[model samples]
Target: MKLLLLNLIFLSGSAAAVELNADGILNSLIDEFVSCVNDSAGPIHQAAMRLFWLLVPINLVISGIRCVFNGDFSDFFFSLVTSVLFTGIFYYLLSHDYAIGKSIIDSFVTMVDDDYMGPSELIDLVFNIDRQINNLMTSNVLGLVSKLQIVICMIVFSVVMFFVILRFVSIYLTAQILCVIGVFVLGFGGLKATRYLAVNYLKLLISKGLELITVLIITKTGCRILNDVIDATKLYEEGLSVLKHSECMVMIFISLFIFVLSKSLPPVMSSLMSGTSGGFETGLGLSLKKYRFLISRNSGK
Candidate 1:
């Protein structure tokens, strides 16, 4: 009987060790995959950036020609200088690896760390829960309902992370593509349509930057609130057997918030960028309307 008990104990310990090793290997593989993707993408990004700069001189010449035709040397010179300056600034940012999307993500991460609600904490919390579940499984203490809840939470967490990461990558890639194409097209000053396209593209770049920041802010704020609730629940858990239920509620709330933010943030960002309330529309519309009225009056005179 003693020998049988010893054998069982040894087998259990070995099984647990194997499981942990498997998890570690899986995590390492994921890290390597992400690194590989970043390395592969670097050259493509650089090429797009280079092409954008190459088109700047062409755009300047076209703008100069258009201005000369309009008999507006001052406007031509002003546009030339401003366009060059903006292009230079963008070039500096791109060359120095200060990509707007990456910068916003890093800044938000830093802010969350300062507020004691970093993503690392969330990751650790999830892993800890996973560990607990594993232990329960080994000890035969995990009920069917408890196992289901754990599985559901894990699935939800994975889905949220996957979609969030996908959206972020899409936004970053789109911004890069737009910056290249938009700057190149801005050279075609003779086409009124191209000019409008260029302006809209510029607005789009700004919108992308704003959208990233807004999403990060919302996510971080949500995480912080969730963390606070979690901490409060821990205090209450000492006197009650409601920890699992509390955690379930918290996880559900987090998942819902993430879904809502992902679905709603883009539209809010677009509206903000449109300047419907003291933005580009209000200023530009009023200015253009007044300019047209003045032109009509002058023509009548």
Candidate 2:
């Protein structure tokens, strides 16, 4: 009897532990994921910072010589001061683990809440929506056509969200890397190369800023729409009518609109950066063209 009682006690303890584990699983997972990313990025950031510091002196010497040859003493002095300030500021920020990418991510998380749902949470929500629709259809709670439409809407929403997440991550990483390496490349390269590199880097920075803003807008809007859908589901569970045909259609249209924007925005950003938009040139491109035109006109005179 004592052995049987001990076994029962063990089973009860195990059940309680399982319940606790399940309750904390999502938070645990998120914490570990963030920790892993920080750990992995730390070494790369350090190496990049070191390389940048090493290149700074060499770049400044070259730039100084070129400026003197061009009779631009004032330009050389300005560049020197700016370079020193930029390096010091970035070094301090990087040493404290406060990269621009991390700042952007933190801003996004805070924009929602402490309990912001990431891509994984979004995927789970999609799955739940699909499952709920399936159950409703199987129970004859909704018409077949209506159920199918809702299912399709869920799928499209999931696909668009997935693509958005993928694109955002890619752009964030690319921008961070470019910003890190761009200074060295522009500084070491000749006058023409420096001019081009500066233009490109500026364009990239602007594009990245725009992408983050777009992400913020979409995330806030999508979350609000999702919450409404979730509330509707709760009402339906309470025996209220929900998932009307018109609602399903609207959801599908919204998802498609988001998908189109996600796919199209990046290309438009690229075109703008390259100054390839029909008849609309970026300031950098126009400035370069004007500079060349003036130089040629002076040479002819």
Candidate 3:
């Protein structure tokens, strides 16, 4: 039994180690190595590797500032990462001849086969995707309508939350304010007697207000997140329009495509063209030489 197991292991390992064709293996290795190098380089090219590394701290600082103002640091982080991933995926789909679209289609078919989400669920997902896509090409009038909707909804929701917070905060502040007024009304003798009492009362009120406001702002932003999707739609439209108007859309796409194609095409085309040109030059040289030799022979004879 041990001998059979050992033999089986050895046979499997040997099969796994089967040699690949020299040229094919070399080409594949080079393509993969190039991709690895580029991935390691991050956003910029090889020359800016250090610069890109430096941007990491800068990005963190920016995120911190955003968090301070918005108080939704977690949401900010989520949006940042999601946007980067989405843009990278979109750029690949638009620029490359890698059949990314076909892969997406295949995945949908596979999902149906796997009985993951039902057809109705898939249809709802498609509708949401359509809404997002349509949101991009949407006109300013439509954008205004959407923004208005968000504004009204957020304003209403934020007001409700703010007031709920305000009610609690007001109770504390009102008590403190009333006590302060009480001190003034009662005179220095009364305040001196109740100094500790007054300070404690004010401290409690301020602390409660701080806590309530923090919760209120965080809750408000959380409620506004769905509306911010519309904001994203507006931003995307502006960015795409700028690229389109600048006539750089095609160029940008081609530039990105070349990054992928650089692995496969440039060297191949260069070699093929060089060989073809060399052959043509050689044929022309030979023909000219043969004509001269024939002419000389005829003249001498």
Candidate 4:
């Protein structure tokens, strides 16, 4: 029941792009996504700088105190040293407007724009395709079915194109939110019990990177099909049905095929690599398990 409803939602525009920039939609979206990330990330960097002075030392002291209670003197010494070194490295990476963070974000965008989609080639192709559809819409010779085919292809293709770019907005924004909060989680690094919280945060960053790589492969395939559609659209001319030019039928089916893959591929790709994030036992994980057991026990009482 829920699955059917989910499929219905997937077909809707909300699954893809919220807003389309008809003027320079694709590139403008790409540009805007990059812009929004840089803007939101600024105050985060500044706040981290401020907190570097205040919270890091405090966290270290707390960790050091906890270490004394939890471990031997040698263990506490090494943990403090390790925490200081790790924190220093993290701070350096985040310094200068989060060069590391922004670089990671840029790499994802590059994979879509520069690599998979082929910037001008892809965008120019979309424009060319849109212009052809415009021509067909203007043509009085084409019947309803023919016109509907072209219109559906154009709409689905546009959605997939915009979705491919806009998808990163959610990712980058989530990453920004994580950074703002996750910086403090790094403080737990010195304590063995809660250290996994910090480790998991790093793991999540890598997971997002890996997710982009998967999306890049999907985008590459979609763009290639789109390129073929461009070639097929050339087969159209005055008063000719797709029956006469079978290329139009083939093109419509394949273009529609892309929209299905756009929704289906991510979950398939993610499932195949399900072990990427989990599979490790951490002190925090163990503590959470114990905590949950006690909560359940108290509820039974």
Candidate 5:
């Protein structure tokens, strides 16, 4: 594991020295990964479509019966039209392997604060951090305690980085699965009793988008962690208090905040989204929620 970290794709001797290829993190992996997801989801999509086609008529008949008793002719017509329309949309998205899914995530990532570092900047920061660690180790810089601090910070910091990447892949995989199975989910809209299933699925998509944005924001620019590491190192060189200059404890807190609590971000945002009217109609089903609270407070005043 230590060897892997030292030789990590971006953490190598230099950032520009490497290119992602078949032997490493290749572009084909994403294409092939999506291909695999589509292949796996194909059968599921077929089954869902078949079942939906079979059941959609039954649901509409049931809804029509209910509408007759309630004397809601408008409601019957509305349900009939919306069921077919929503199902068609679901089928179309599933057929495309959720191409717009990633686009949504990318849009969320871009919605982050302008001053925050991006993926490219994050990569460069990691490279500089790796070099800094080597520099402190090779030179006669600090006392034993000071060097130990760097080691502790690096270990915790590296774990956070690993989890960020892992969470990203996990999000991508889940979004594809949800997009595919959403055929039946949206098909549930044909009946009033099951309409919430389709609505919740849409909510879940918004939540999933929130999850993707949360992890990226944390690793990309949320904490300024890598900057902290560099700042502490420079302070150590100037003979500051070993404990004071050592931001290892701060590193642990920041890293753990990401590693543990980041999962809650989605559900939290989901709860807030649940409160809003016309969620799906909002376009993207959500605004950039990072600023939503501030937006709310000002409006109330």
Candidate 6:
């Protein structure tokens, strides 16, 4: 059910991208990104590790600054480290033998082919894919499906573990945060000093998530637009395609706009609220309440 909701959310304004055979591309990207970072760290691996840890927070601070200026933060839960994980996973998904890229193209083609029955076509595509998947499940000769499911489960488990580790680290860091607050209370006796740290940390988190989501949305949108632009010349000869389908194109554009807006708004709101004296506390509380309401509403839906 959660997966279904995530899929819907991801597909809200956009069609799924084409399933490119991107295994090589994924590995290459990971290697390049990692190697660049490592090269920047010089010869010693331990020194590199320390520098990387230090740099991660700096990146988050940078993201926060960018978010403040932009007034839009979406998907900021993903920090620099987590964003790297996400990017790697994304690259893997795009590069792997997953026919997601092809499926995306097929969807576009199908949508374009039958303009009048867009909804019905979507349903048919779902069911057709479902039928094929069911057949694969029932056959199970190569155990490919089972292996894939296990891999997915492992990925999910790893994510859960990451969150668990993050929680522990946050808890461990709380003592230092409190110590700083303690010193402030003792030195000049200002409780407001504590507020600064708390607010900044919260801003950091919001900014990070927003930036990560922004990257994902931007990359995905770029891919879709590029594909459409490239296919423009051959769209006529290619029979029905997304670019040829006005309705789909409109939907895609609207969806992308919403994605960009949603990602941008949160951090802007956070930054604005933080700038005022009591605004951060009030806004943070309200945001939390609103988020709770949203979760409840979505859950019910």
lDDT of model number 4? 0.55
Better lDDT candidate (4, 6): 4
Alpha-carbon shift of residue 230 in model 6 (angstroms): 2.6
lDDT of 6 at 106: 34
* Model 1 per-residue lDDT tens digits across residues 9-104: 345434533333423432333333344345544665556466555666667777788889999655565556555655664555455442454454
- Candidate 6 Cα RMSD after full superposition onto the native fold (Å): 23.5
Order of all candidates by TM-score, from best down to worst? Answer: 4, 5, 2, 1, 6, 3
Off by over 4 Å in 4: 1-23, 63-71, 108-124, 137-165, 168-198, 238-252, 267-301
Candidate 3 off by > 4 Å = 1-179, 182-203, 206-233, 236-301
Weakest 10 consecutive residues of candidate 6 by summed lDDT: 182-191
Q: Which ten residues in a row have the lowest lDDT in candidate 4?
A: 1-10
lDDT for position 194 in model 1: 36
Top TM-score prediction, candidate number: 4
Tell how far residue 178 is off in model 4, in angstroms. Answer: 6.1
Instruction: Put down candidate 6 lDDT per residue, 197-252, tens digits, no spaces.
Output: 43443344333333333333333443344334334423423434322234323434
lDDT (tens digit, per residue) of candidate 3 on 1-301: 2232224333544444333432233223323333433343223222222332344345556656776789864546553653344334323322332233224323423432343332222223323433654554354423233554433443443334323333323332333333233222211111122223323333333333333333333323333432443454456566643212222223233223322332333234334323333332235446655765686679679
Instruction: Please list all clashing residue pairs in model 5, or write none if there are none.
Output: none
Whole-structure CA lDDT of model 3: 0.36
The local distance difference test score of each candidate is 0.52, 0.54, 0.36, 0.55, 0.59, 0.36
- Model 2 segments more than 4 A misplaced: 1-46, 60-101, 104-124, 144-157, 165-206, 234-248, 265-301
The TM-scores of all predictions, comma-separated, are 0.51, 0.55, 0.20, 0.63, 0.62, 0.23
**How would you encode candidate 2's per-residue C-alpha lDDT over 1-301 as one tens digit per residue?**
2233224334553443323332343334334334434555655556656655666676678768877998855557655655565456445544544355455544634565445654445545555666666666666665335655766777776666656555544554455554454434433222322334434544556666566556545555555666676667666555577557777777677666765776676566556546643221245446555765686679679
- Per-residue error for 13 in candidate 3, Å, reads 92
Error of 1 at 290 (Å): 9.2
In candidate 2, which residue pairs get closer than 3 Å at backbone N, Cα or C atoms, i.e. clash? none
Q: Give the winner by lDDT: 3 or 5.
A: 5
Candidate 5 residues 18-71, lDDT tens each? Answer: 455423342333444455457756576566567556666787788688779988
